[model samples]
Target: MTALTTREQIVTTADRLFYENGYEHTSFADIAAAVNISRGNFYYHFKAKDEILTAVIAARLAHTKTMIEGWEREAPNPEARIRRFMHMMIANRAAIKRYGCPVGTLVTEMAKLDHVAREDANKLFGLFRAWLGTQFRALGCGADADRLAMHLLARSQGVATLANAFGDDRFIRREVALMEEWLTAAVAHATPRPDNRRRQH
Candidate 1:
């Protein structure tokens, strides 16, 4: 693979730092030190910390979109796709235990700081909400799709918060299994829309 440019490296490092250290707490100097670059070179790439934050948010948005798209392509059906989303907790259990969900913590910190990029950071959650809603709709949830989407998001957020507090991998595993079981029951109860039923017939 090709190497990331200096600007890309700055944004990536900033993203990790922002997640590990709150946006309000992390300074440009911190990033520069982590990247082992001079202030002059850092300013050449990002004139201010806000610019770095904007770049980080944009990069995260693009990465999240790509991930959801990949799930859509690889999963055989909507239920499987949703399962993949739920399984993310188990997949990133270590990180969740240490730092909490990256998106959740970032958004929470941004909100607390009253940061300018709070809305921009929140778009990450919006992307997942929309994608999950689509999967629920496909499963014949119809008007309830958005509600179910939010419910799943809230559940995951709660699990991440508790997991981080407790640092329990077993908790993550149990929650993931519970979520999978919930999805299976939800799918069984979801009546196919008229058009979908006709198509199957």
Candidate 2:
């Protein structure tokens, strides 16, 4: 694989630091050191911390869009796509156990700082919400799609939070299994039952 460009390297390093350490705590020098670049090079690429923050958020948004779209293509149906999303936690259980959800932690930190880029950071969740909502809609959720999307998102965030707090792989697996069951129940409920009576409409 090709090495990341300097600017890309800075954003990549900053993204990890911002998640592992929190935006407020990760210094410009820290990112520079991670990328093996000088402070002058860093400043050349980014005039201020907020600029780096914007780049990080933008990178995250782009990557997340690609990821969900890939899931949409890989899975045969909406239910499968949604399951792929829930399975993500298990796929990255170790990271979630160590640092919590990256999106959750970074967005929460940005909000606490009242940083100007908070909304940009938050678009990560928004992207997932919208994608999940589309999947729910395809599952016949109709008017309730967004609500179901938010419901699953909220529950997953809670799982990530607790998983980090407890650092338990078993907990993550158990919660994910429960989420799958929830999805099955939701789909069943959304699917219109066949009726024996003639059309009322």
Candidate 3:
């Protein structure tokens, strides 16, 4: 595999540090040390911490978009695609247990800090919200798709938070199973509009 460029290395290190340590807590010195680069070199890549944050958020957004598209290609249908999302809690249980959801934790930290990049950070959640909404719309939720998406997102975030707090893998498993069941019921009971039905058929 190709090596990451110095700029990429800096952003990548910052992303992990910000997720593992709160954004306000991670310093340029910390990221520089993690990347094994001099602080002067770090300044060349990122003049300020906020700049690094913007790059990190952008990287996350791009990675998330790619992941969602991969899920669409891999899953057979909307229900299955949505299930893959719900199953992410189980898939990343170790990380969630260690640090909570990356997006959730970052947003919470930014909000508390009253940081300028709060909106940019929140776009991470918006990406999931929009993708989940698309999946629900395909499953015939109509105008309720975004609401359903938010509900599922909220549930996942809550589970991640509690799982991190308690370090409980069993809780993660149970929650993931419950989400799958919820998705199945939602898909079964949904009544698509006539136009939506025609489109599906």
Candidate 4:
């Protein structure tokens, strides 16, 4: 295989180290070693581990946004669109099972030490929540759209954290199931119950 370019090597190595270890535990030395570059050469591309981490965070954010957008496009209706969003999260069960949402993980771990990192993390969460708010409104989710949007975001991240910490599939399955149930309730509650719609005897 063609060797990965230096920048790609650095990013790939950083991604793995940061995900497996953490932003705080990972260091410049680890990155240099992982990329097979000396410290001097590594410094040529990145001044500090923070710079590399910023790049890694940016890349992950872009990747996530693109994935969520693609899922949105594939959705056929408001409810499916919402369920698809949840399923898209379910698809990440493996990653969640391993590393958790990188942005959420990093923010919790490094937010105090790194303002820039925290800002980037906030951007990722804000984008998802905003997109969800717009989607819920589009689906006529009424006054509860905002709350429900926040709830969905919280539940997704919370489950990912639990999965990562506990190393259990039950967290992933149960959380996604709860999200699906909530989506159904939200949709039903948003719409007026028609008198013509009769209940089963």
Q: Pick by lDDT: which candidate is best?
A: 1
TM values, all candidates: 0.93, 0.92, 0.92, 0.83
Q: After superposition, how far is residue 133 of candidate 4 from its true place, in Å?
A: 0.9
TM-score of 4: 0.83
> Candidate 2 on 69-129: residue-level lDDT in tens?
7886677678888999999999999999999999999989888888888888889999999
Query: Model 1 lDDT vs. the true structure?
Result: 0.90
Clashes of 2: 0
Please say which candidate is ahead in lDDT: 3 or 4.
3
26, model 4: CA deviation in Å?
0.5
Instruction: List the candidate numbers ranked by lDDT, top first.
Output: 1, 3, 2, 4
Alpha-carbon runs more than 4 Å astray in model 3:
1-4, 192-201
123-174: candidate 1 lDDT, tens digit per residue: 9999999989988988899899999999999999999999999999999999
Instruction: Give the per-residue lDDT digits (tens) of candidate 3, residues 91-116.
Output: 89999999999999999988998988
Question: Clashing pairs in model 3?
Answer: none
Provide the clash count, candidate 4: 0
Model 4 spans with C-alpha error above 4 angstroms: 1-4, 191-201
lDDT of 1 at 154: 98
Q: What C-alpha lDDT, on a 0 to 100 scale, does residue 197 get in candidate 4?
A: 20
Cα deviation at 67, candidate 4, in Å, is 1.0
Lowest lDDT sum, 10 consecutive residues, model 3, at 192-201
For model 2, give the 10-residue run with minimal summed lDDT.
192-201
Predicted candidate 1, C-alpha RMSD: 3.8
